[model samples]
Target chain A: MDEIKEIMLDILEEMTGEPMVKEDLDLNLLEEGLLDSLDYVTLQLEIEDRFGVLLPPSEYTKEELDTPRRIIDVIADKMAV
Target chain B: MSVRFYDGFEFFVLAAILSAPAIWLGVTERRIRGYGIFASIVVILFVLKDSPKSILLLAAYLAYELLLVRLLLYLRSRGKAGKGIGRLVIALALLPLILSKLAEQLNIGGFAILGLSYMTFKSVQVIIEIGDGIISDVDTADYVYFNLFFPTILCGPIDRSRRFSADADSVMPKSEYLQLLGDAMTRFMTGVLYKFVFANLLALAGTDRPYIYGVYMFFDFAGYSLMAIGLGNIWGIKTPDNFNKPWLSVDMRDFWNRWHITLSTWLRDFVFSRLLRSCMRAKLLGGDRVYQACMCLMANMLVMGVWHGLSANYIAYGLYHGVLLALTELYQKKSGFYKRHKNETAYKAVSWFITMNLVMLGFEIFAGHII
Candidate 1:
């Protein structure tokens, strides 16, 4: 779970060009004026590239990207698949 | 005879006529079965009203689509892309575009007259996405509707063929149909206000007034974009917003983001970014953010020139914008001001004013060219 969290944060920062503090990281990234819908797509792509897994583009919705838990959970589920 | 356009009088006349039971009855209800029948008549009407050449044009467009789709299937069925096939696809897609624009400029050949500006970019955008494996499966009807989308044919927001198909194939509810129709009408009325009212008034007032002259462009173009969006809604389709209060922008980047937004996004995705990346790979540019930023602006403006049509004034406009982007980038490097700014809205507003002025001047130059 920590590894998943770390990976998602790294991807977000790279795309957003904004740093995320350890305490500040959460679903707030979506609503807190950091990442946008376009950045979400980039995040999804980056996850697949990094994990060496197939995450079909359609499954990653804007709602899903709003939280850390959901994103990490998705990456874990897809990797297992 | 003096040609009279649909003004207040004509609009009321048109609305009354359109609302008459005889007009849209077949389109709206029990005669909903007449949808395809109505569309066929539309095609036939254009062919007759415009020219016999429209028949050949339609055939040519269809053939081009068939060739593009089948060739992709053949290539993919064989195996994954071998060698530098990406460049090959771009070149192939761009061939007609280059020819079409060059033809328009050189006037050496007959005009394609089939919305080539809109269609060519759309075709190229689709193929690029497909090449990137962003899209894989699409059928013949999707391809046809993307280009032949009627309202956008005459005037365009230059919606891409692939993007249109992707959105169209998605699930749609019957409930969405009524909402979409209502939305279309409301949006269409807003467009009418923009085009016939605000833009018309500004141009009518005279270009000597600097502010009015500047704002006229926003009204004129954003009006057309609204119309395109409205029409797209009617078709249960929608395209990207091509304007975002561009006149209110204060810097070149903001201006680009606001004005002719679809073209700007399209160029950034397909042209500017590609060029900037290539320049980076060639070692012709530095790896740092500032250097990369400069390269991006340069690449962006150069393509911006070509996209507007290969003309001297347009090229100059592109260069002018490139200089603005480069200058702002230099300022950001020196001041680190963009970094410290927490209030993005304030920063954007300041940038907006500056950007809009620059773009308006470009419009002035374009207007001058016509005069």
Candidate 2:
């Protein structure tokens, strides 16, 4: 879970071109304008490359993965399955 | 017989009549449950404006979508939300809109609805989301309201089922409603200035100049989009803005981000992103990101162009933008010079000028004057 969280934050940092902190996890990525629908696809690809688990595409709305926590949850859920 | 602008006396009167009660509800009760009533009224008004015969055809179309959703839900219950089933349901949802466009091309009449294209887009989103298990349950009333959300039905910022559902299910707090009201009025007045004052002036100046026509179109359509967003606010539904300083964009991708934003995002989400994902999964182009992106951008833009119309001109328009966008992606990623100078102010200015003109050319194509 911590590994997934770190990977997610790394992807966010790469996408946003800034170092992300722990507080960023609680912020709504979409609503805060840190990411967009298009970026979400790219983020998924990055996660797949890093973690080797590709969340099913088009199976989830951005809202489902709106926060870093939610993203971690999705990745963990898929990995567990 | 079609009422187009808010500036006209008739439209103003109709808007006043419709908005009065909605506003009252927003101010007093803070819970606007009249979305159904408002949506129904708009559907009726649309039919009346287009053709009374339209009501029957629209009802059939709506019934078809409703039945389609029911079938999709049933399939999910039966654990049949497989890839094939998803494609079939999406195709079924799109059929009426596709047929309508085809009929128009064939010069056949009487098979179209006023907001069929936008309605179909919403329906497909709902079906896809449901199949994904994102939307677990379907409420018939909510579905109706979603499709018929009048402010954006005619031309959309393409609100999503999940986001819109959140708004439709809750009433805003009084403070929030007041803030929304303020934003709504500001947007509405800005739209009037754009559409009525500026765009009309540009139109009267003549469209012989391609660039002039482009500016005219931006104001005209952006004006409508602003009004829709604002009107949506009045109704307590937070409609997304379609335009965002599109002319200031520095590339095709940036232009898309800033212009008719919702439609572009819709194309990205439903068409481009899906194509990209499927290509990645299938290892198409041997996992070459550039080749995959180029293919997806082309397909996405072409579909968007064809969605506007089936004519050769429209197809060309789509291809033109598709090529530009693909090229922009290639340049942004592959060129060392671009990577080095992309952030420099001078380089940025030149890129902005080039992108803005290209977009204007696109608008000219949309205007159907320049082939």
Candidate 3:
């Protein structure tokens, strides 16, 4: 879980071009403009590459993957399965 | 003698009379789904009675799609749903709509079914979801009701099957139903004002001007959408909203998120997202993310435009927005200045101004002004 969190933060920081802190985990990535439509897809792609878990955008909504914590949790859950 | 949905005062009067029982059930906290379905059938029959051709077409279309969906579900249950078969079924489901569009383009008569496009969207969504194993079972009555819900039969805010079923299957509390009724009344009245008063006035004021036409389009379509939503609420279905403050959008992408929201989101989900995922998986454009994104946007917008109609003007309108969105995507991602000061008020104001003009220009192309 810790490793997943670290890697998710790193991916987000690279996409947003800003350093992400632990406090930013609960922040809404979409509302905060950290991710737009394309960036969201890219984030999923990066997660797929790193974690080997594919999250189809259609299956999961924007809200389901909105926050950094939620993203990490979803990825981790899929990985566990 | 084809009667348009939500068109005349008589239609609303008839709708009110037909919906009275369902509304009563809703207010009394009774299950309204059965009555709602009955009312929808009543309205659909009345609307299509004058046109035998349309009634036949609609019936045939419904039967075809329902059977197709059932077959797909059966296949999925047996664990024999191959990707090739799934894709073929989707294409087959789209065949009627594609043929209808082609017939219209060819000036052939007898294939013009009202609400075909919206119905196709609902059917395709179900098929895709079932293929993905998201939806396990589909009740026949619920499927029919979801597809033919009269309020949204002609035009739509395009409610999802799962969401619609959840609302339909559950009973709303009296207090909650009453609150929804009040909101529904407000939305319906506002729709009346928008469609009958404002849109009519705009039309009378001359839609020859591009900006006038654009605003007119909003009032007219949004008015229809509001009334549909209001009616859906009365029937205990929380129909999705179709518009927000689109005129104030800060970019092309933002505009899409605001305008005809359901359709844009539908395309985004089923078309754009899927397309992008496949492209990225294939490492298309040699793994160039920007180019891949641009290509997907263009293809997505073209599908949208062609969905409108196979006309030169409509194609141009779609491509125009595609270009604008691609450009917006590029600017936002690549511009250093944009990154530095994007959150500032002045920058957003300028962006809003630019986006509005570009939107109006697209509307002009849609209206066949510049094509």
Enumerate the candidates' DockQ scores in order. Answer: 0.20, 0.37, 0.60
Candidate 1: where are CA atoms >4 Å away? A1-4, A14-49, A52-81, B1-48, B160-163, B166-174, B207-210, B276-284, B341-352, B369-371
Candidate 2 lDDT at B142 equals 78
Order the candidates by lDDT, highest first — what do you get? 3, 2, 1
Q: Which candidate, 1 or 2, would have the higher TM-score against the true structure?
A: 2
Q: Per-residue lDDT for B184-262 in model 3, tens only?
A: 9999999989999999999999999989999999999999999999988988899989999898899889999999999
Comparing 2 with 3 on TM-score, the higher-scoring candidate is: 3
Pick the winner on DockQ between candidates 1 and 3. 3
- Model 2 chain B TM at 0.95
Clashes of each: 9, 0, 0
Candidate 1 at residue B327, lDDT?
Answer: 81
Winner by DockQ:
3
Chain B of candidate 3 versus the native chain B: what TM-score? 0.98
- lDDT per residue for candidate 1 within B29-83, as digits (tens), equals 3222123224533543433454667557655765775677667656766776653
Candidate 1 Cα lDDT to native: 0.63
